[model samples]
Target: MAGLDDYQFFSTLREKDNPFWQRTSDDRDRLEDPMDHYRRPTEFPEDLRNPAHGTPGPPPTKAPAPTPKFNELEGQKVNDVQMEKYGELSINIVSLCAENLLSHPFIVVRRQCQVNISSHRYHVLPITIVPALLHIQSCQGFSAFWKGLGSVLTIKGITLGLEDCLSKFTPWPKDISPHSSIKTIGQHLLLKSSALALITPFYSASLVETVQSEIASEKPGVFDVFKEGLTRLLSFTQPQTGRMLPVWLLVVPTVTHGVLQYILGNSVSTLTSKLLRRLHRNDQHRQGAVSKDSGSFLDASIRLQSAFIGHMAADVILYPLETILNRLHMQGTRTIIDSLDVGYEVKPILTRYEGFFDCLNTTIQDEGFFGLFKGFGALCIQYALYGAVLKFAQVIIQEVTLALVPPKPKPKIQDPVTPLAPSAPYTPSSIHPGISSLHTSPLPPPRTPYGASPATRRPLGYGSPGRRQDVDMRAELEKHKSSLALDD
Candidate 1:
């Protein structure tokens, strides 16, 4: 069969009709329309016939009533739709705060880091804004800040809910539930990667270097498709180039964060747990939230713990990479504002390193490896604050949201088959509502008119205390007759 020509084999197989391999004639194949819209059968089978009269019988003695689909349970629906919407609004606010707080450290470090003119040997000094002045920011900066927060609330928020559905498929072990560190990092990767992709335009707009870098370039590469694509995306906007952030630059940190945590999480948590357990031998420590787990705060959630510890640790150890990435991205990226006019201005904030390794090598050669750790302090605060706000808000909001949402009432399901119909109609009682309700007649007690009670006593001829004998009817009649004649 494998070697035979297609025509020869197919023809032979088609012509052959051995009984074992043959197919019976089908009325369906003869249909004028092979793809007939309807398929209901025209013939009736024997089993389908009614047992009572050799034909399909009517429905059973009592057919079950169909249960109607309804939005409400019983007679009541969810009480407050407005309250739910309000809570949703507050949730968005919280998300914005969390996202901004998380990214502040990176922003501060990047803002301080300097750049040179394209291909220049010397580094330009940074225009340092006083700590308090960081509060005042560019219009483009506000755009990026709000965009990141909105992305977290809408895109990341929805993604988290969908991710929670993964739990519904299986009740995985404690190591794999929503609590697992590896699993949680994976969640972050999914969440952040998507969020980054969604708001890339805004991030690009926020960073002014993109346009500036593109302008200062002697030759543009085919790889600069990112800026070109972003320009198309923001075609409707006034300006597109310098006001934008690079997608890869923004995504790299989140991607790195997840991977680094995945690699370092188990070891760090294990060592931390062992150390926490050695705190005291008191019996009170035997059982409690803080007894065994290691986290950001005492007895805090593992997510908070992982984010705070993992992010800070990664920042410090890999702070050079962090700085390098920031510099790589921030070089020639700036958004300018003058008077009431808003537009993007090309300004190279860092020009020494064009790529990852270039930045890494340059930083080491010029400023030593310590240069990477420039924003370590601010970055640490950012990570720590993010973890605190995250965990604290989660715990508080969980309770608050729970309070806002009404709990589901247990169903009042009735047994369908068990008939418990009342024999009599209800009669209102002449009594208080809290007291006796239906005025049912009280039953009479058991007793008899005879001396002996009916339960234990026997008939007259039986062995009872009082029994009747035969009456002397003839003797009583003669005596009655004589007495009557004398009286007459």
Candidate 2:
């Protein structure tokens, strides 16, 4: 008859570091087995036997009156489950075939080629290959039958989400400088370097110094054009270092996938229309919803067609890079983190550009047509969800940062005095806000000479008469020259 309090109190006195005491305190049920008092249910309860319980019983054994069967039954009976299973099987077979045909050596070569082409186009190496490989290894225990499928979706989702979020707040050209003199060319270059810097450390800082040093080398204006063009291209694809796929390979596939889908989608829609027509034609005695003042089957069919098209289109655009990006991350490159110390030689050989195509075509030839779409089925799901979330998050982060930090204002200049014709009617546009006309009448300029003629003038020193007017005119000319210089 030991009390629970007695055990706990005694355990604390044993010492804080005592393993036995700690275990006893941490798991009271384990130390004192409660299953010793276990019980099992044997019979039904009184409430269950009572007819008052809300349990449903068998239906009355009676026949219903006959009614005309709608042809909708035929439409509904088209065996959608079977169709779905067939589609899944087709996807599996196609992906397997593609993988088998595309040999490991070819894949490696294609991956290396992707690195080269992407690096050439972007002027920076995407070192995500290492991370991508690592990811594959870690997840390698999973069946190769569905290889790259999950990874592709994950990569797409993250990259798209990040790009979307970053785009909204820090929309291109994403200028980072606070200095007014460095606003246009300087800031643009900074952004480009910054994006690259994220992947390859210190690239932006080095680029800045390079530009400044090169300022003395060329017509400074030519460099400005270079900065602008490079900035725009880089902005088009703001690559994130941690994405599942390397950013370089993301472009061609996404665009191609989107286009192909649009073309195929239209065909599928036509097929659906023919199927719906057949169903409507088969049923005469059965009154359709349209005939009874309800919604038409045609409308439902079209909606379904539209949904199907949209789903397939989205999948096409986002699926290819899904596993590739993940593969990139798992096989991440150290080059990104150590970009500053490393000097990259930017060059693209013909071999680099053709390698990916060779691998792709070879895989198809060996593995059958399905090899081209390896990992696509799983990727479809992955891209749909991942792309959506990643895009949204990145956009939000950029927007929030920009909104919190607004730009500063610049300095202004003072306008000088000017002469105006009294006979000419001066319009509002002709007059400067800060500067007023100096009168040219016969009057001694200001001071003790009150009520003098307006045309009178002043002297430089006490003896030099009308000399101040000459000085004033020269000053005005210099100011005019300065203003003109700024405009040019």
RMSD of each: 26.2, 46.2
Candidate 1 local lDDT, 1-488, one digit each (tens): 22124334333333332121333365336535554445322334435776776666665466478887875653333444444445445544564576565664344333343322222211112222223224323323433322223322333444444445444554422123335687665554555445444444433333332222222333333334345435634553333445333455445663564355545654566555445445532434666534343322223333334444654565556555545555554544442211111122333353534456766787777776556555344454555567667666766755676686677678799878975654333222232233222121121222224687665543222222122243344543354455455556
Candidate 2, residue 444: how far the Cα is off, in Å? 99
Candidate number achieving the greatest TM-score relative to the actual structure: 1
TM-score per model over all chains? 0.36, 0.23
The TM-score measured for candidate 1 stands at: 0.36
Residues 83-175, model 2: lDDT tens digits: 334444443343334333323222322232222322312111224233433443354322322322333333334334544444466643443
